[model samples]
Target chain A: MKKILTIAALALSFMFLTACDSMDSPSPLDTRASDTSGELNPDGLPGDATMGADSGLQDRGLNSINGFDPENINPEDIVYTIYFGFDQYAVGSSERDKVKSAADFFAQNPDMKIVLVGHTDWYGTEEYNMLLSDKRCRAVSDYMGNIGTDPSRIEIIARGEAGATMDVAKNSPEAKKDRRVDIVKVK
Target chain B: MIRRVFLGLFAGIICTSALFAEDAGTIRKDAGRLNVPIYRVAITSSDADTANLAKRAFGTHGSFRLSAPSQAQFIFDFAPSGGNSVKLTIKGGTVYEQVFSGSNSVEALMKACDAAVMKTIRTPGYFAGKIVFSYSKNGGQTSEICTSDMVFRNVRALTRDGNDSLMPHFSPDGSKIIYTGYYRTGFMDLLLIDLNTNTRKVFAAYKGSNTGGSFSPDGTRVATILTSTGNAEVWTASANGGGFKRITNTSATESTPSFSPDGRTLIFAGDYRGAPQIYTAPATGGKPSVVRTNISGYCSEPVWNKVNPDLIAFTIAQGKGFQIAVYNFRTKQTKVVSRGASTSGPKWLNDGRHIICTKSNGANRQLYIIDTETDSQKPLHTTSFGSAKEPDFAYTAR
Candidate 1:
């Protein structure tokens, strides 16, 4: 009776050791399978049949994992639409919201990189517009940093007054559309 | 009738006093020293005839008379005729005379009239060692280059039929003239004209508006502003037009380029800084740096003083008027050369002591020479009725 009791204790400790070892592996799905299989097989391990059945159950369970659902996967690419005030690059309340959205997306996906492209209307001089474009890009980048986005993940570029979308007409809605920052996701 | 007569008498007294009193001092002094008497005369005619008709009625004397019909006239005797026939001659629309023996009544009168008109038109100290400039007149609506004396006299129209001919720069040797002209195609190209031969040949058929043609210090190449890529930029090509190299990029509007005294630096006005300001770059083409800043006004048309490399003169607008100011590279300060009103097109004389600039009096514009040492300015020529501007001092023509 004593020998049988000691053997049973040893068997139970072995099962626990295997469970802990699976938990330390890179994938947590393997340990989740062992939790469902209660029996120790003749090979001194969970039976292959039971492991296979558990894997099937794990596959079904994977779909319900929080934040891991395929349908809930955030896109690797992000588009940040920045609207500028009339003849200004100062980040206003509305533009700050756009920047915060971009930052949040970046925070959720830390592996992604962003390019902050600045554009301007055709109303001002080319030289001044070029500088303003640079300022706009920098402003967006700064806002992203304020909201927990890595500074290294952002790059700034300027298009100046060239490539204007507003047909050279200032104070128009189309011109205001031209003066904006296009945050594109690279990789 | 009585009131009219009294008013005429009062006007006669005022006119007589003004003419006799103010005129007597200078006229008598000059005449007495020259041993001559000054005279005033007028020719009367009937109501039925015109002034020319009345003069014709006087016969041969009409042409020679010092006084013409229905016109007030004055004359002064210079010297007794020294057997040189008192003949009236007109050249370039100016009248002159030479005295001779056996003078007819008409001949004597002609000689005296010629002497008086010559005295009034002739300025002794004017246009001496001065350079002239040719500008498109008639508000730039026509392609005519009008010449003005450095002080702005003798404004003769140089070219009448050549439309859009501009940037007339003298060659280094001063024997040839180079300019850009549009020939029917509406594209300005470089042209060289031999001043001695009056022969012209197209120097460069640049693709776009080739203007602001300037001769290199050695006269081997012509540096000009070419708008080849739909944007104006500085370029250098062979003076006879073969090799072309763009000196500036398409990112800016770079025009009005002036070479430094050493020809190693090119100074130009560009929109690189969001406004038209002076910038200097390597003559071989490189990054350009700002030369004039701090003043938030438009600064254009830079001319380097050949003798004083440290000095550069350009026009800057203050309020509603533009003034000519010189920037000293060493001193790092600007001095205004023009006083009130507007000034433009400041060109330095070879001596560097004076600058010829266009001065406008709100109503009319003319050329004025500003002395750097004395800070004094004087009108170059006072006879032109039409507006005159853009005085470019000729360096090689000396």
Candidate 2:
């Protein structure tokens, strides 16, 4: 009877340990220090919120003045468009989740390649918009790299107003839909 | 389209019959509403179809007016060939009487008219010139390069790659065209095409981006933008793509570099000061200076007038859109050339008084030629392609 009791105790202990391991395993994106509060850095980059004084995200290659989250993104999602502010390449606090989600998707699909096509509205010059779109794509690429996506699997394209999702004039609310980076999966 | 026809009909019935009919005996120098020089030409064709084609071709032109064959200063006669060809002859008060043969009767008649005007006015004729522009196809995913006459007739594709090709610029001598192509998707390819041979080659296909190519007036070099070294900077290269020299070194983007008539200076658009503005620099590369213009908003795509060196036309951001504007160096005045709608890509015609630009209504984009002196803009009639933009003019002798 004692032997059977010991065997049951061992089984219970193994089950508890397995559950703990499952909970303790770090996310593929967790290699970089994260904000436990799920709050994004106001600087449009990602890192520990407590270390805001330091340019934590800047050192990680993020150049945006605002932040976005790409967490909890599914790789199978057909398309994801992240919009930007007026004449701004900064992914703001409200948009950080998209970045985190993109990072999560990239992490989940190791062999997948993504083309981040950046676009702008018809407000600025074509040359200026081209550069602005490029800067936006760089910001996204930096965040993806920060969260453990292989840089080689990512491509950035500055489409300017060429890939505009909305056909609206400048200064209109609908025009804001054009200023975006479309994350398209190629693999 | 209705407005254009109404204006034409109004001028045809009211001005031609009422105002100018009484003054037909005297040479009406300023008969049209625009108050420009008037040249009356009588057009005659061997067939009624050819005669109707000639009338339609010349109706939209802002230059000559029609008159009775006996009282006309110039006479244009068209002889049709067995096929789609026509032999055009122009003779009258000018020392020019020539017979030119071409495939299309309409195009042949227009060329004959242009030649006649050039003989009388002693100015460079734009009617016989061709324009190379970018047209969006396959739902804007790809763009094809096309060439058309100034009247936007007889359009032929220069590229069938169905890729995103933009910013077509004519070489100084009109023998070649240089453009930026996206045949490789995310990569840019600077392509050069020989108009005579219809052959294309990669002029500068760098890794990052290659765009904004403009040939120098001397045709010895080309100024363009390359991002091979981090950021987009203005760079000049040999006409044959042999030697390359970087022109601007800025963290910001520099683009659309055009050379002055003397080939000593270059005017380009840059955002070094945060907002895009026109800036001038020496062709040999040196410290750049801001263009002294009265425009307060974003300015870009500044092209130096080939005939009038003192005038520089550019695109300025306007109310909910963009418009074409000209900055006069001699008067230090800035005048808006385009009106009512959004216009971009202001490229100067050889006439120095007119410019070709892209005008959009947030849905459709088309090419329009604006006369700066009159502030009059007319849409170019191109083949029913998707959206046509970025037109470059090349003068071809007929």
Candidate 3:
């Protein structure tokens, strides 16, 4: 998560035309400031030291990757699961009320964290469905983000056709019912 | 794995040195006509289970016609040895007879059969590989990650019941597994199960979805789908599950990042060009280039062939269902190799010629081994344990 890896040297490149990588050496990339502590300093580096302009670290984390507390504290389920449209991640206008419900839940329980477990119908490949489900989670998260929900308190999981019935037709309402995100409240 | 296979040539067991001298008689004369080879082989085993399973494995390849010892070119005789080992004696084969041991007799027999494959067919035998998949009972959301031999022998539960554990991938050596499990926090977080220690820990508890965790070839780094950054993107972490680094920077959803056998490039699926297409990016941060499979508009879950890195196996959307297709980089053409009610989630066995995938017919989702070279598909195991999907095979040499 915003990890600044030091390119201690520039010569070592992964050139072992083999299927195995020994856990040896200084571990080519992502040295993580000091250790694998998962701790970030204010500068998002090990300490407050300003990163060198030629560090080439910004290219690594152009998209910020951050860690979250995985504690499952007194989790509760929100009845309204954010249903995504067929092969779509955008939260429908009708689903806005469900997002409001989540917003209201977070507002009522200020110390709670929201877990958006994503899903998809039996429409495409498993991996593609995973991404589609993930975008659904993000859509709901972004909507709640507009409601001022802290991203840190939200954990999104893309389940991707995990719960869908295989025998049913692809477009059946039972199958489409699976293409949604289940909301859970955690501490 | 080809690297290991080459290295295996020098350090290979004394019995398997005849790789180049494999008998050509077993290969059909007109092979490339349909990518199928029908070899006449005979299996002699005192154990019915061993013979039946071996025949199943052979038939699953859509090759090998059962024949008498006198008529067969490759003959295999299996006998239980002192321990959990199988003593395989070949009468009509090139390789010398040897003993293959495993945790049990079935595994031992598979090891022997796989060895026999290398000796006669000149290819890796994945029958001895370990398979990990999520098993859902009666099509429920709650599932468990289970491990078994290729034929579903010695099934062991890694995760518990009443929790969703999906897409478990095997590390190169078959000693560790990384999967997206919600058994812990009720939210999908990547979990690593050390098969040796029988312990599991959170590999990626990132802010967003952490799914599709697969190990890099050499078993050093793990490629996973972490959505924390922007959208779903391919990210790499150390084998110890630390020092995370993002590989592909894309706003389009990215899933299933697989390292080339050389571990230099990554082949993954992204919707950047509208529909899902296979794309390759440098293992290090770089721009991603599209892999024009052209077989279909939707191709996802791309995995590099371990034995033959140039070959790629992915799920391609067919007329109404999806099937496994192999795209040969050299020919720049794709071949659809599987025919199922709905087959997807294909992972290559040690043998580049064969693949392990899931075939769903009605409510029955079962693991199957498909011979891409012959377009032969056969069930690896039964649905007695429930439906299985997303199988990852870790082939360890015997």
Model 2, B27-144: lDDT tens digits are 4243221244456678787786566546544443445567789877667777675454566666552223466554565566556656655555445556666788887642455677
**Candidate 3 has which clashing residue pairs, if any?**
A1-A65, A19-B217, A19-B218, A20-B218, A21-B218
Question: Stretches of candidate 3 above 4 Å error?
Answer: A1-81, A97-115, A147-157, A182-187, B1-37, B68-71, B93-96, B138-140
TM-score (C-alpha, index-matched) for candidate 1? 0.46
Model 1, position A16, has a per-residue lDDT of 73
Q: Pick the candidate with the highest TM-score.
A: 3
Error of 3 at B246 (Å): 1.2
CA lDDT of every candidate:
0.54, 0.67, 0.72
Output the lDDT of residue A88, model 2: 78
Compared with the true structure, what per-residue lDDT tens digits does model 1 show for residues B1-398? 99999988887676455443323322433221222223333333222122222222122111123353234333222233335333332221122345433323223333343343324322111122224344433343333344333322123344444344454676666656666554333334555655565445556543334466677777777777754443567777676655666788856667677788888888878766555789888888888888964454677778788878988988775765578878889878787767875777787765555677777653355667775544557655442344455555553221
Better of 2 and 3 by DockQ: 3
Fnat by candidate, in order: 0.00, 0.06, 0.21
TM-score of 3: 0.78
Cα lDDT of model 1 by residue, A104-175, tens digit? 877887776676666787544333354456567767877888778887676554545544652334567778
